[model samples]
Target: MTKWLLPESLADILPAEARRIEELRRKLLDLYRVYGFELVMPPLVEYLESLLTGHGHDLSLRTNKLVDQLSGRTLGVRADMTPQVARIDAHLLNREGVTRLCYCGSVLHAKPMGLLSDRELLQIGAEIFGHAGVEADIQVIELALESVRLAGVEHARLDLNHPGVSRAIIEADPALARNAEDVADLLSTKDVTGLRAFASETPLQAGSLDALIALTQLYGGGEVLQRAREVLPQLPQVGQALADLEQLAGFLSDYEVSFDFADVRSGYGYHSGIVFAIYADGWHDTLVRGGRYDGVGTAFGRARPATGFSLDLRALAGGLAPAEPAKAVRAPWGCDPALSAALRALRAQGIIVVQVLPGQQQSLDEFVFDRELVCEQGQWKVRAIQ
Candidate 1:
C-alpha cells in the first residue's frame, strides 16, 4: 500500500476544484454578513459531551471520537457546527436579543453518507438564535434557497417536513410513542410493508395505525397539505403543523415547494419543528438541510429558539461547472529593481503573476499565463503572449 493513498471515501481536492470551493465560501460568508450574521469559527475538536450535547444518535454515529492526551478525556471531531454555534449563543455571547451567527469549516464524518459522498466535508451555514416565530424560519429558508440560486443551481426543489405532525400522532398512541425511533426509521424509508409488520407486532390503536399508513402517501406538491387534512387524524397538533406548512408554502410561492410527512424525522433528533431539505436535478441527494431546532441550547444551560441551514461546499462545487483558470502574467526570475517593482505592482492590482524560477518548469493548474512581463528598452511592461 502506498503511503499517499487515502482511505476509502476520502479524497483530496485539486487546484481547480479547491479554488471554486474557496470562492463559493467567500461569496456565502459575505452574503451572510449582509444579513447581520456575525461569523464565528468554533474549534475543529472539543470535549465529546460538548460536541454531542442536544444532538441525537445520528450525530453521535457520525462524529469521530478520540481521547485527548493532555486532558485524559474523550474528545470528538465535530460532524456538525450548528450545536457549537448554539453553544456560543447560549454561553459565550449570552445576548438578550436575536443573535445571528454564521460559520464555515470542515466536519469529519465517521462514514460516508452516500456512495458518492466524501467522509470529509466543507460545511458552511448561518443560524438565527433567540427568535421563535415562523418569520425566522422564512428568513433561513429564503437564505438557503438564495444560496443555491447564487451558486447557479436552477430549478431547485424544496421539500418541507414537520416532525410535529408525526410526533403528535405518535404521542396520541402509547405504543407508537414508546417505539418512536423505530417508527421514525420506517417512515423515513417509506417502508409501508415494514410499518405494517411493526404495527401488527405491537399493540397500537386502529386510528394510530391508519394515520401512520396515511403518512406514507402524503407526499407531493402543495395539494399534499389538503390531503393530509382529510386523511390524517384531526388532532390539534396535526392541525397546527399543517397550518404552519401552508403558511411557509404561501410565502415561498416564488419557488418550487412540496411536502413529505413521512420524512418525519430529522438527521439529528434536535429539530423541534419544521424541517426542510433542498434538492436539485444534478445532485443525487439533498444539497442543504435545516429547520427550527428550538431549545437546542438547553444543554448549555440556556434554551433559545433557533433555525438555520447548512450545506457541504465540496458537494456543492462538485455539481457545478469547473472554474476557468485565472489569467496571469509570466515574469522571468531576476534581482533587477525594475522586475521586482513590476511584480509587486501587478500583484497589488489583484493580477496573478507567476515568477519563473531558475532551472524550473513553470506549471500551474489554477492559472494560465496569457501575458509576459519583459524589459523592453530598459522599461518593464506587460505584452500579450503570441
Candidate 2:
C-alpha cells in the first residue's frame, strides 16, 4: 500500500490545532459581526474573465488556469478573494452606498513546488465597498488591529505606508515604471547597491532617487515619519500620504498602538493608496497586510471606493501561544429527576450546572460557576456562585 502523504505546502490539520484555530477565528469573526460586516462565502473557482478583469498582467500570469468542461471555456482557480468580492459587489450587490463584507477561505495560486509558501493559502479578511472617504480607511485599520488583539497578541504594531510615495517618483519619470519590476526586486531584497545601479541608468531625477533610497531605510516609529519628510521634498502626494497617517496615529493614540510611516510596498500591484502590515510578538512574519484598491471595481462597471485588510490564518495559528484547557465538569450520579430537569433548563441558558450527588459537593465551590442552583421543596434556590 502506498503511504498517505500530503503534498508540499498543503497540510492535514490535526483536530486539536484545528479546533483551537477555529475557536480563535470565531472570536474574531464575532467581533466583526458586531461592527456590521456580514459574512460571505465565495466560490473557490470562478471564470477567468471575472476573476482577472482588474488584476494587472503580472498577477494574471501567476494565476492557475484550467478549462471548464461544462461551458467549454477557460476557468481559473481563484488566486485571491478580493477580486472575486469586487466582482460580487459589482454584479450582485448593485445597489450600494456602503457594504461591509467578511470572508474566510482557501485561495490557490501557482507557486514553485517544494516551497514553504502555500499554493493554497487560508485568508480571513474584510472589505468595504462604496466608501471612498478616509473614515472607511480608519474603520478598516481599527478592525484589523482588533482582530490582532483578539488573537492573543498583547503588544502589536501597525505599520502604515502609501503607494503614492513610490508612484509619484515613477510618474515623475515614466521610464521608471518600465523598469519598476527590477526596482521592486531590488527593494524587496534590500539590495541598495543594485538599486543605485538601476537608478543611475534610469531617467529619474537625482532628488527623486535620493528620496526613494532614503525611504528604503526610513523604517521604525513616529521618528521615521520625520525622516521620510526630510528626505522626500517637493512631492506633494507623499506629504499628503504622510499627513493622513499622522492623523490616523493621532486618532488611535489612546489604544496600545504604535505607528510607522515608511515607504512600504506590497506584492499586489493594484494597491493605489494606503498599505499596512501587522507585526506581533513571537512571529517570524507579518500576520496580515492589505491596502486601498480604488480602481478595483472600475473594470467591472463603475468604479467605487474600497479599502480592506486580510490576515494570513496560517501565520496567525503559528504565532498563537497555547491556551489552557477549560476545566471539565463531572456529572454527579443518582441525580433526582426534578433536579435533572432544572439542570437542563440551566444548560439551555448557557449555565454550566453540575449535579453533586451523595459524594463530595464541596469541590463545586472551587469551580467557576456564575450561580449554583439547588432543587429543594419542589422549587429551585439560586445562590450566587463565584
Candidate 3:
C-alpha cells in the first residue's frame, strides 16, 4: 500500500474544503458569542471514568481507550464533548446563575456514527447549564436551527420528541418491567406488529398497552399531541413532557416543526427530558441531534440542568459548500516598496492575496488566481488576468 493511503473514513481535508469548514466554524462561534455563550475547550483525552461519567452506555462503547505510557492508567478518547462541558460547568466554574458554554473540536469515536460519517468528527455546539425550564431547550433549539440556516442548508424539518412519554408509561406499569429495553427498541423503530406481539402477553393494562402501540403511529404536527392526550394516561411526568413539546412547537412558529412520539433514541441514554433531531434534504442521517439532559454534572458534584446540540463541521460543509473562493488576486515577489505596500493593504482589507516566489512559475489553477498585481502606468495595480 502507498504511504498516502489512509484508514477508512479518516482522510485528510484538503485546502479547499478546510477553508469552508473554518469559515462556518467562525460564523457559528460568533453567533454563540452574541447570544452570551462563553467558549470552552476540553481536552481530547481523559481518564475513562471522567469521560464516561453521566453519559450512557452507548457513548462509552463509542469511546476508544488506551493505556497511558506514563501512569499506566487507561485513558479514553472522547466520542462526545457534552460530558466534558458538563464537567466544566459543574466543578470548574460552578457559578451562581445560568451558564452558557459552547465548544468546538474533534472527537474520535471508535466507529463512524453513520455509514457516511467519519470516525473523527469536528463537533460544535452550545450548552445551557443551570436552567431546567423549557426555555433552555427552546433557546438551544432555536440556535441549532439558526446554525443550519447560516450554513446554507435548506428544507430542514425539526422532529421533536419527549422520551419521558414512553418512559413514564414503562415506569408507571409494573407488568412490563423486564422487557423495557426490547419494547423501547420496537417503539423507536415504529415496528407496529412487533410492538403488538410483545405487549400482548405482558400483564400491562389494556388501555395503556393500546396507547403504547399507538405511540408507534403517533407522529406529525400538533395533532399528535392532542392524540397522545386521548390514549396515554395523563400522568404528571408524561403530561409535563407533552406540554414542553407543545410550548416549543408554538415558540418556533417559523420552522418546519413536527412531533415524533416514537423517537426513543432522543429519549434514551442520558436524556432526562425533551429530545430533538434536525433533518434536511440529501442527508442520510440527522443533520443535528440534541435534547435536555439535566443532571449531566451530577458526577462532578452539583447537578445542574444542561441542554445543547452538536454537529460535524465537516459534514455540514460538504452538504453546503459555499461558492468558489472568490477570484483571488495573485502577486509575484518583488522588492519594490509600493508593490509590497499594496499587497499589505489588500490583505488588511480581507482580499485573498496569493504571493508567489521570485522566478517561480506559478500556475493560475493552483490558487484559483483570476487577477494579478502588476505595474500599470508606473503604479502597482490589480487587473484581470486574461
Candidate 4:
C-alpha cells in the first residue's frame, strides 16, 4: 500500500478542480451577500449533542464520531452545517424578526455520497429564520433556483414537493397508521403495483382509494396542483398543504415548476414543512436539496420559523469548467525599489504576479507565465514572453 494514499472514497482535490471550487465559492457567497444573507462560518466539528440537536438523525448516522481527548466526551465531524446555523439563530443571535444566514464548508460522511466518491462534500447554503409564511418559502425557492442558474445550470428544473402533502394524506386516514412504513415506501418510489395491493387492503372508501392511487401518477406541471386539490381527500391538513403548494407554484410561475405528490414526506433532515430538490438537464444527480425545517432550533433555545437550501459545491463545479486561469506576469527576483513597486502595483490591480527566484532556471511549463516584468533599456516594464 502507498504510504501517501488516501483512504477509500476519499481523495485530494488537485489544483485545477480546487481552483474551480474556490472560484465558485466566492461567486456564490457574493450572490448570497447581494440577497441580504449574512455569511456565518461554523466550525468543521462540534460536540455530538449540539450538532445533532433535532431532526438530525440522518446527519447523525452519516457523521464520523470520535472521542475528544480533553473532555473524553464524544465529538462528531459534521455531516451537515444546518444544525449549527439553527443553534446560532435560536440561541446565539436570539434576534427577533426574520434572520438570514449563509454558510459554506466541508462535511465528512462515514459512507460515500458519491458522484465520483462522496465521502466528503463542500456544502454551501443560505437559510431564512423567523418567517413562516409561504412567501418566505417562495423567496428561498427562487433564491435556490437563481443559485443553480448562477452556477451555470440555467435550464435546471425546480421540482417542488411538500412533506406536508404526504403528512396530510396519512392524517386523513388514521387506519394508515399501521401500514405507514409500507405506504411511505410505495409512495416515495411511486411504485404503482405495490401501492394498488396496499390500497386494496385498507378500509378506505372506493372514492378515497381511487384518489390515493391517482396521487402516485399526479406528477407534472401546474396542472398537477389543480388535479391534486380535486382528487386527493380533503382533510384540512391536505387542503392547507395543497394551498401552500399552489401559492408556491404561482410565485415560481416563470420557471418550470413540478409537483410530486407521491413523494410523501418529501424533505431533508427532518424537514417538517415544505421540501424541494433541483435537477439540472442531463444531470442524473440532484443539484440541490433543501426546504423548511421549522422548529429545529427548539433544541437550542428558541423555535423560529425557518427555511433554507444547500448544495454540494464540488458536484456542480464538476459540470462547469473553471474560469480561464488568470494570466501570470512573472518578474525576476531583485531588491531594486522599481521592481518591488511594480510588483505591488500589479498585485493591487488583481493581477497574478509571480517572482522568479534567484538563479532558478525553469521552463514555462513549470509554472504558468504568459508575460514577464523586465528591465528594458534600464526602465522596468511589462512585456510578453517571446
Candidate 5:
C-alpha cells in the first residue's frame, strides 16, 4: 500500500468538504453560544477508565485503546465526548445549578458505525447539567432540531424513546434481566421474531414476555404513547416513561415528532431518561442523537442530571450539497509594499486573497479568483476580471 493511504473507514478530508465542515462547526457553536452554552474542548484522548466512565459496552467497543508512554497506563481515543463533558461538570467545574456547555472535537471510532461512515468524526454537541426535569430534555431536543434546521435540512423528523420502559419490563422478569444485554440488542433492532425466539428459549414470565412483544409494535405517531399506556404492563416506570414522552411531544408542535418504544439503544446506555434522534431524508441514519443521562456524573464523585445531543459534523456536511468555491482576489507575485498592503487589507476584511508565488502556477480547489490586484497609476487596485 502507498505510504499516504489511510486505513479502512478513514480518509483525509479534502478542501471543499473541510471548508463545509468548518463552517457548520462555527454556525453550530455560535448557535449554542446564543443559548447561553459555554464552549468546552476536552482532549482527544484520556485514561481508559476515566474516558469510559458511566458509558456502556458499546462505547468501550468503539474506543481505540493504547498504552500511554509516560504514565505506562492504558489510554483510549474517545469515541464519544458526552462522558468527558459529564466529568468536567461533576469534578472540574463543580457548579451547583444548571450549567450549559457545548463542545466540538474529533472522536475516533474503532469501527465505522455504518457502511459509509468514517472512523473519524467531528463531533459537535451541547449539554445541560444539573437539571433532571423533562423541561431540560425539552430544551435539548429543541436545540437538536434547530441544529439540523440551521444546516438547511428540510422535513427533519424527531424520534423519541425512553429506556426506562424497556428496562422496567426487562427487570420485572428475572430470566430477561439475566440476559439484559441480549434482550436490549434484540429490542434495539426491533426484531420481534428474534424476541419471540428468545422468549421461547428463555423462561420469561408471561407478563414480561407480553410487554416485550407489545413494545415491538409500540412505535408510531404521538398516539403510540397512549397505546403504550393501554397495551403494556402497568408498571410505575413504564407509566412515568410514557408520561414523559407525552409531555415532550406536546411541547414540540412545530416539528414532526414520533415515538419508538423498541429503540432502547440510547447511544452509550448512560441515557437514563427520554432519549431522542433527529432523522432527515438525506442522511442514511440519525443526524443527531442525545437524551438525559442523569447520574453519569456520579462516577466522577458528583451526580448531576444531564441532557444533551451530539452529531457528527462531517456526516452532516457530507449529506449537504458541495460547498461553492470561494471568490478570491488573485494578486501577482511582487516585492512592492503597496501590493502587500492591498493583500493584507482585503484579507483583514475577511475577503479571500491568494498571492501567486514566483515561478509556480496557482491551483486551488476551494478558491476561484474573480478579481485581481494590479498596479494602476502607481497604486495597487482591485478590478473585476474581464
Candidate 6:
C-alpha cells in the first residue's frame, strides 16, 4: 500500500480548476476556428520513432516512453502537441493547401512526481501548416496576442526573436554556430565578460558580435525593434527579420497589443524564424511559446512555410479567474407525492434540489449560497427562496 502512493509532481485538478481550464480551452479553440484553423487531435500515444524524429533534441528527451501492452512496441506519451501535429501534417494532411489545426489535451512527460510540473500537463495550441511568407508568421503572433486578451490576461508581454538571425550569424561563421549553445547561454545571462572573451576567440563578424552584445539590453514594446534595426543595419537578413516583426506588430496594433524584442534569448533552437514567448504579469513562466518552422515541413519532403503557437493550459488556468464551484444539494426525505413531484420538476429544470430530513440541516442556511430550491407549500403553493 505504501508503495502505491502517488508521485509528487502529479496532481489531480479538482472541479474548479478543471472547469476553468475547459472554459478557456473552448474559448481559445473557438478563436482558432474563427481564424480558419481546423481542429486536430492526435493520438496521445504513438511509436517513439515517429514522435521523436520530428521534435528538437531538447523536447525529444522530455517525452515519456513506455512499451505498449497491446503490441509490445516502444511507445511515447506526447511531450508536446506541435511535433505530433507536424507528423500528422507530413503523413496525413499532405494536400497542397494550408492546413490549420487546433488541439487541446494532456501531454505526459517525465518529471518529479506529484509536482506542478508533473508528468501530465494540459496544452491548447494551433498550428498552421503549408503557409509561407512573413504574413503567416504575423498571423500567428496576432492570434496569440488576441487569445491572451480573450483569456483576460492583462499585462501580457509578447517577446519576439528571429532564430534566423542567429542562424545567419552561424552561417557567416560556422565555428560560432557550432558553439551556438554556449553563445545562447551567455547571452541569456547577459554575461558581458563571457561574451567579450568568447567574441575575442571566435572568428565571428565583428559587427554582428557587437550587435549581439547590444541586443541583450533590447527589451520593451516596439521600440526594441527600432533599436535592433539601427544596431544591425549592415546585416540584411537580420533587418528583414526585424521588418517582419514590425509587420506582425502592425497587425496586432488594432488590438492595442504591445510587444518586446528579445534578441538575446534564443529559445527552441529548431525554431527557424520569429520565435515568441508570452508572459503575463505575476506569472513566472511563459504562458505560450511558438514560431515559424519553415524547414520543419521540408524535412518531411514537403516544402512549405508554416507558423503556429500553443498555450500552456495549466498556466493559463492558474492565471484566470477561479471557476464557480458546483453547488451542493441534498435530497428531501418526505413521503408526500406532491413534494416529490415538485422536486422532480425542479431537477428536470437542471436545478439541484435537496430535501431535508427530520434532524438534518434543512434550512437554506445549511447549504452553499449558490444552492437554491423551489419550495412546495404542502399542497397549497410553490415558492422559491430569495
Compare candidates 1 and 2 on lDDT and give the better one: 1
Cα lDDT of candidate 5 equals 0.89
Candidate 5 lDDT over 84-164, as tens digits, reads 999999999999999999999999999998798899999999999988887888889999989999998999999999999
What is the per-residue lDDT of model 4 for residues 1-386, given as tens digits with 9 covering 90 to 100? 68998888887877777887888899999999999999998999899998888753456678899999999999999988899999999888999999999999999989875456578889999999999988888889888988888878868888887767676666566766556656776777778788778776778644555665777888988888888888777778778878888877888889888988776533233777778888886465788988888899888879999999999898888777544555799898999998899899899999888888988776543247889999988788999898
- Tens digit of lDDT per residue, candidate 1, span 145-188? 99999998999999999988998998899999888888888998
Q: What would the TM-score be for candidate 6 when compared with the true structure? A: 0.81
Roughly what TM-score does model 5 have, to 2 decimal places? 0.97
In candidate 6, stretches whose alpha carbon ends up further than 4 angstroms from where it belongs are 1-5, 69-73, 112-119, 189-209, 255-268, 299-301, 326-386
Winner by lDDT: 1
Pick the winner on lDDT between candidates 2 and 5: 5
Clash totals in order: 0, 0, 0, 0, 0, 13
How high is each candidate's TM-score? 0.97, 0.80, 0.91, 0.88, 0.97, 0.81
Given candidate 3, what's the lDDT at residue 44? 97
- Candidate 3: pairs in clash: none
Residue 181, model 3: lDDT of 68
Candidate 6 lDDT, tens digit per residue, 1-386?
67756776677776667777788888988998999988888999898877765455556667888999999999988887777788778777887777888888888767632234556778888888877776777788788988989988887777777766655665566767778767766766777788789978877765657766775676677777777767753567877777777877776675444444334342436677678888888666677888887756555666566788887788787877666655554555767687678678767988666666678753453234344444444452333335
lDDT of 3: 0.86
- List per-prediction Cα lDDT, in the order shown: 0.92, 0.73, 0.86, 0.81, 0.89, 0.71
Total clashes in model 1, counting residue pairs 3 or more apart in sequence or in different chains: 0
What is the per-residue lDDT of model 2 for residues 39-144, given as tens digits with 9 covering 90 to 100? 9899988889888876666557668899999998898887778888887787778756898989888887676322446666777999999887778888998999
**Which whole-number lDDT from 0 to 100 does residue 369 have in model 4?**
80
